[model samples]
Target: MLNIVLFGPPGAGKGTQSQKLIDTYSLIHLSTGDLLRSEIAAGTELGLRAKTLMDQGILVPDEVVIGMIDTKLKENRNAAGFIFDGFPRTVKQAESLDSLLDQNNTAISGMIALEVNEEELTKRLLLRGQTSGRPDDQNEELVRKRVQEYNTKTAPVAGYYANQGKYHAINGIGEIEEIFTEICEIIDSYATQLNA
Candidate 1:
């Protein structure tokens, strides 16, 4: 199994790269944002709870998010591997994820951190906002806030993985295919290591 954690700041192309990885490797892509949105759309109990917190601009409780992820992991147990995106946002969540994967007798084979300049990220986000009609991207203040929040909360998770010697930093700025190539190389190298 080739479990991976895809880490990057907002507008770092994590989503785009994740799609490519999934296609190339037949890996399950587990995006917490997508999962929460699906839950909210379904109006399930967990969705309702997350909706209340999200509507208020507050962070959803960790347990709720973790529980949702736990369910997804079980559902995808038969997959060759998984790419976790937009998850393990905090150190606490990272520890929790480690425990959860350990219980399933799997471990993160590697973590790919996409590195992009803040200016480039902001420009990309603004363009995305214009094209996608995303309210958060449309507002400069909100975009800045999101970037800051990601730095404050999500960036540390990279360190957590780094300490485990599973972190690979990849340049995120470039054509989509180029970035995907970088990520693919890292994953392929890890696969070779596992096989050896």
Candidate 2:
């Protein structure tokens, strides 16, 4: 399996790159946010709980998020691999994911971190807000808070992966295609190593 973790800040285009990777490699895209939304939309028990917290503008507890992810992973067991986006945001979660994958006899192949300047992120986020209509994006204060939260809570996970020698930093400032190319190179390198 070619399991990958796509890690980056909010406006770093992790989603875009993940999509490209999925298309090129046929990896299952396992986005926590998307999974939660799907569960909520399906009105599952976990989704209901997550919806309550989300409705109140609070983050869902790690256990609930992990439960949702566990379900998705099972469903995609036959996939070529998985592209994890917006997950393992904490050290505990990262450890938990490792245990889960270990139990399944699989492991993370690599973590791709898209590196972008904070100023560029802010600018891109503001522009995205104009069209996205997401409340978090529309509110500057909320946007800043989200960025801070990412830096404080999620950024450390990069270091954790780096320590494992599975972290690759991709420069995120450039045309979309250029950035995708850079990411592709990293993925190709890992794929080669894995096949070898």
The worst-scoring run of ten residues by lDDT in candidate 2 lies at 133-142
True-vs-predicted CA distance for residue 60, candidate 1, Å: 2.4
- Which stretches of candidate 2 lie above 4 Å from their native place? 43-45, 55-58
**Highest-scoring model, lDDT:** 1
At residue 184, give the lDDT of candidate 2: 85
lDDT score of model 1?
0.86
TM-score of each prediction: 0.92, 0.91
After superposing candidate 1, which stretches have Cα over 4 Å from the reference?
52-58
Best candidate according to TM-score: 1
Local distance difference test values of all predictions, in order: 0.86, 0.85
TM-score, cand. 1: 0.92
RMSD of each: 1.7, 1.8
Q: How many residue pairs clash in each candidate?
A: 0, 0
| 10 residues in a row with least lDDT, candidate 1 | 51-60
Error (Å) of candidate 1 at residue 74 is: 1.0
